[model samples]
Target: MYHYDEYDRALVFERVAQFRDQVQRFTAGELSEEEFLPLRLQNGLYLQKHAYMLRVAIPYGTLGARQMRTLASIARDYDRGYGHFTTRQNIQFNWVELAQVPDILQRLAEVDMHAIQTSGNCVRNITTEAFAGVAADEIIDPRPLAEILRQWSTINPEFLFLPRKFKIAICSARQDRAAIMMHDIGLYLYRDGRQQMRLRVMVGGGLGRTPILGLQIREGLPWEHLLSYVEAILRVYNRHGRRDNKYKARIKILVKALGIEAFAREVEQEWQHIKDGPAQLTEAEFQRVAEGFAPPRYAAQPDGDLDYGTHLAMDRSFARWVSRNVQPHKVAGYASVVLSTKPGPAAPPGDLTAEQMDNVADWSEHFGFGEIRIAHEQNLILPDVRKADLYPLWRLACEQGLGTANIGLLTDIIACPGGDFCALANAKSIPIAQAIQSRFDDLDYLHDLGELSLNISGCINACGHHHIGNIGILGVDKNGSEWYQVTLGGAQGKASALGKVIGPSFSAAEIPRVIEQIVATYCAYRELDEPFVDTVARVGLEPFKERVYARQPEVSTCAM
Candidate 1:
């Protein structure tokens, strides 16, 4: 966790005072709704269906125990007694008073956190792999670099109000947990043959109206040129990216229209100016950022009688959870635990009560390092749990409804806060997701349908990441009724691919059945131990499309 310096403190103090004035003006008649829109949005305040929603950034999804406690307090004092963890690893309070936003931000600032770039057209949170510092397969920790970007991009003067929102992600690990390829700017850090660290840059990956897996434009960019390279790419996009139509404004559209070669050339031409500028990080600065994130001194040996096998023998459910949710840590005896936010049929994907947040904080402090990681898949990670305390921690999570045995299983769904909360939505997405969850309630059945990413969006804005799901369900409107279109074989991460629609959209009522047909087709055709996504890629979408769209004249074929 990066601590706030005096500079950070002073800047946030000034910004909060500044926003307080803006809010007063807007509340008075000095600013109209039209005039206040961008201003409020810049402050992470959005006018939603019934109230304002405030999304606070949790940088790189890392939260200290105290920061977690502050968030819990905010939920209890400011909004309703809950907070929703976003897919980007941020937290959003769906019901907030616009007037109180500045106060909330001030509190966040006190904790060295703010919502500065979590909203508006500026670059959003710079996410890294949740396992950044602790992953066993990592070449280096990416969090310090992520922090650098966060500081540089926060309230940057030139880049605000860009063509559309930009996302940047970095993965230091060999396994791509960050979903870096699905970002506007994705960086892969690796050590070259000389044992020198470098970055591989990918640009224009996003999931929206036109989903695109980013193109790798530059390889082995040395560590010194990172900030300059980012500045160059952003400047190019800010200058030439689309703004005429909202749908065509993302960098993905620009990359698609200009082609990767041309876009890369444009960025290179700009990079010439700032490649060796003052902003290039020196050894001291990098050390300052890196010092805050050193791994905690762990016990040399186990304090408890170490026997997870005994717990597994006592509880099969606990065994299943440990096998699925636990992950490897860099430390010898420490493990990272994935706390499933995706639980049952009707439960919201990432919503957690204040009590639950506090409990997580307590558990993090009690058993593991007082740090938490929010994953891109709408789950929480206790990144430094002792190998001996897995069962007790699992028990606490179970009591709080945080223990869902499904991690990569079919029941672990990624969905957006659609019509239920979002004003931009055309139809309800949460209910549709709930229906799908209920449709496949059997854990054994869902597990058998292994590693399926079922992403649902209420509408085409694709907030629920419908573009990248192995099975995507997108909502549409037809004669005042909501309908859905299913897409097969979309993926995000190292081997990234966007899903393709099977056919014409099905009515909302007919969607689950359509999905069932597609799944059945998969189950029938898949080789032993093959996942749904693997089976789809191997067999193509023809057989499933044919089964799902049978007897429907309106359905049309689309390629994956």
Candidate 2:
């Protein structure tokens, strides 16, 4: 994990002081709600359903044991006893007091963390693969690059107020876990024929009302020019991206309006000027930042028989979890463990209690190295858990209400705190998740179905990542009633693409049934042992859509 130096320390302290004054003004009525909106948002404070929510950043999904402990402590002391890890690898503390925000931020800063640039339109969070350093397939660690971009984008004077929120992701691995293709700027680290590190840049990919896949402008650019290249793209977007309509504001729209060829030309022209400029990262700076992410030394254990083959031969539940939750690591006998926040019978997805947070920290220290990573899939990642000790860890986790063993199953849903919490939501999404969970309770059925991501958001902000879900559900208010618009076949990977809507919107009551029908459709068409994503991709949405909408009650219809 990268520790905050003096400059980082000063910046956060000063920002908190500024925000405290702003909050005081708002509380005292010196500043109107309208005036305080942007300021509060910039500080990662959101006035939600019943109370305020404070989102804190975990840069590039990296956190030390001490920082993890601090987070648990803050969750225990300030608000609830747990925090919801987000798709951007950040954590949010709901039910926070409006007056205590500055104090909470100060506590976070004490542990070398803050919420700056976690919100507002300026580059929300520079995310990367959670398993950056330890992944066996990585060409170069993306954290240092993510940090460099984070520094450059953090309240940059030029991009403070973009038309809409901007997201950037870097993937250094052979198989992209970062979901880089669905971001404002997606960087794929690659080694060229010359054996030098470079990036395959994808620009303007996002998911909202109009989901757009990014257009690749630069391919195989030298690694030294990463920041300068990114800046070139941002400058072009900042100059020309729409500010008129909120729905049409993302760079995706701009890229679409201008064809990929034209957009590439524009970026090329911009890069010609900035490619070798001062913003271009120097070798020393890159090395300095890279050093911060060097893997911690572990006492070499005996390379003995730590076989999970015996366990796989026995416990079915353990095997299932191991299949979905474990990732290959560079170090032998070590594994990257994904602690799923999604639980069965539809407990609130991504909602963690303060106790759970504390337990997570304890478990991390006891089981693995004192390190934690948060995945972009709204789950916690213990970067280095030993394979041999997983049973004890799983048992302890089950006790603390942390074990679910439903990592990639249908019950593992990604739902926004919709109309229940968010003021902007039109429908209640949590109950829908509950409904689906109850309907789909059979683990055998789920396991058979395999690796389906169902996401629900109140609206098109795609906060729940509905756009990227294998089964994406969006809530809409149809004549003062809540209805869901579902999308199918979307995926988040190296070949990432947005899901397409499956026919008309379904009433609140019909969502679970529609999902059931969709699942059934997949079941009918799937080849032997094929995942739902693969089945859907092989067989288009028409088969699923027809089955889902066959018996729907009277409703208006339009092309999906």
Clash pairs detected, candidate 1:
none
TM-score of each: 0.96, 0.94
lDDT of 1 at 43: 74
Tens digit of per-residue lDDT, candidate 1, span 423-460: 88888888887777777777766655667788888888
Clashes of 2: 4
| Deviation (Å) of 530 in candidate 2 | 2.6
Alpha carbon lDDT at 511, candidate 1? 72
**Residues 78-115, model 2: lDDT tens digits:** 87677777777888888899899999999888888899
Q: Give all candidates' CA lDDT scores.
A: 0.86, 0.83
lDDT of 1 at 170: 93
Q: Model 2 residue 540 lDDT?
A: 89
